[model samples]
Target: MNHAMATPTGNAAAKITRLPFLPLASSAVAKPRNSSRANFYKEVLESARDKFTRAISFQSKDKDISLAKALHYVAAEDEAYLAYNREIDAFALQNERSDTSSPHDAQGFEAVENMPMDGKNMNEWLVEIDAIAKEVEAELVSRDIGCHLAEVLEAVNKVLFETRGFKRSHVVVDSKCLYLHSVLSSGSASAILLSVIYIEVCRRLNLTIVGSRVGDEFLIWPPTGNPEELFKVTSGRSLFGIVNGKCVDDPRSKASDINSSSLLGLEIATNRDIIGIALANLIRFYWKRASKTNYGLMLTSPLRSAHRSEEKFSKDNCSEMPLLRPQELRLAIMASERLLILQPHSWALRRDYGMMLYYNREYEAAVQELSICMAFAPEEESEVLEPFVEKLHLMRLEKSWKSSLGQKGRLTVT
Candidate 1:
């Protein structure tokens, strides 16, 4: 929307513009095999296709549409779902080697493992989390729970529920813990550690928790739930009771009092979202660190490093990152795009997207995207962009100034 700051041209246009979207057709379809896991994804894709087909039912019966348009419509509804399902399938195949032994001996056997359901009873799960917290408190004397932030989070995740047959919802941490990691440790490491913990905890507990890819915060999906209702769930709780980015606790309020803006917040999101935020935060963190030095070299180092690494991987016959690489930041960008689709007004997602573009070497486009992000930032964080933007402006200024000096020197020599 901040059209004043058009990108330096090229890919920036594609990155910032609201890409025109289209719908799919009904007649073209691809049937998937019926394995349980395959079938689950297949059903989702089919349902998406069906819903899209239904929406376009009014189209002229005699008219024909391209298969590409139909695919696009289905993709628009659920890009992340399709992307992740494909990743899951590819990973399964890559691990599926010759099984000369029993079915249990298969490397990909765990792909079909039943979803964790330890939290069928909320009371029981809560008791288990409490017990694990106590154990962690007790273990501080025996083992250093403060080795690495990720390790601490991982350890807590593993011991918290495995001992008591329960799992805590996304890794719970106070503002203090996040501040320590973000300020004291490496930004990427800190973001990833917290995100992994948050995600793994939810998985263990079978809770519908997500990583809030926006801020350095995490929350369970639904903060509250009814025990008596047939489909009652505590996960996926709306934060709509929050107004102007803060929660309200009025005694007169009912559950339904929460509004759309507050309740539908995307707090617990996917790993993709986490990675996006991490990348965004990393850019800001690096920019800040570079600003204090008053040198342009700092700005180029990390990006060049990333570019080199990306090049190395490509040369090694890997076009994309391997799943075993826990810190696949690219996945986070895709996740951020998904979040942006779901919650377009989210300044956080916009920030992440801009940062992603910046790292992807779409510098001018990155600046344009980030300019929009700066405009939407709350008053408190508005100043956060001033230094970074100034640095970019200064870099350009210095380059031109030096160029002029070089030209004048050449003229003098002549």
Candidate 2:
């Protein structure tokens, strides 16, 4: 078995450890200005700044400074995000634990218990989701439902779309749609998130449903197993497969089979992928916001329909545009960094991070990271990006030469 291609199919899959659901934790985030919390925040900020400055000036030579400090910041931010999720756990536990009033409130805890806390709390909103699944299951079971696959799928769809009112949103630039809490709260989510809801519900009902790409978007496919068998062997839920890098070496495979293994043999998006997607959504939010303000970074094709285009994302009626402001770019970079925290092995993530570094104008750092990306990227992707990466390398080389010349007091400006 190729080490990279080896998969934990069947029993071997059970041994893979995951981010555990720890006891509900607390956040040590700094408080508001003029308070004790403010002091802590200021101290941390100062420490990070000091580290950053020393790293830049090569004063301490203790830490590589730029990469090290950025990673440290990412680590701390990752912890804070987990803490935020813990808060959600506590909230869900508190709200849905004691309440036997509604089936959702009653079973919500079970759903929360089922999902491991992995720095995100869409699971916190999942208790009600569990309740809905049980309710749907109970109703279907009561109707003496047969093992007809299409009928079962229709039932699942009706319960979710009509009864629960779960629907897809048109907003590509809204980060709120990515959060399960926000989705349940708003009764709307993006295609991916809504598909998540569908998959979760079906899985709870012992359906072997999976989310697969349909066109440029994703949808939950119906189960392939026997309904009775699904009901019988229900105890633990399977972990979603991780997309550590390119989804597939060959894009051709993706067009033919949506369930094809991703790099690292990830058959589906893991919790890390979902979190990465959410963070990417945040980056898009800022990008979209900046687009409206007529300033942004990279641009994409126009929306397929007006219904989905929350921001016009247009200026000269062309589908593409550039609109990154410094602050917005920073926020996007931080989100991408957090995604890297969640998925360290992701080559695609490293590529995005390197591009973000370029957007931030740290040419040398960008080239360094992108150089690593060259080793991991698909052959075709590498070919397409080769010229751009070379240009960045050249820019960094010239920059280093100028600095060295200035240090020698031999720099001449023409």
What's the residue-level lDDT of 43 in candidate 1? 44
Candidate 1 local lDDT, residue 69? 27
Off by over 4 Å in 2: 1-123, 141-151, 225-285, 290-328, 338-349, 362-364, 377-414
Model 1 over residues 148-208: C-alpha lDDT tens digits?
Answer: 3323433444453344323211232322222212211222224343434334344443333
Candidate models: Cα lDDT each: 0.37, 0.48
Over 1-414, each residue of candidate 2 has an lDDT whose tens digit, in order, gives 222123233443333223221111111232332333233333443343333233334233422222222323323343334443344445555556785332122113222222223333433444667777887777678779785655556567667777777666655655556555556666777766666666667667767555444344553444333323322212231112111111222364342233322312324554334444556776676555644566433421221221133543222221232444655555566566555555555667777777766655567667655555555567665554455555456666677877898889964699
TM-score of 1: 0.28
Top-lDDT structure, candidate number = 2
Best by TM-score: 2
User: On a 0 to 100 scale, what is the lDDT of residue 297 in model 2?
Assistant: 31
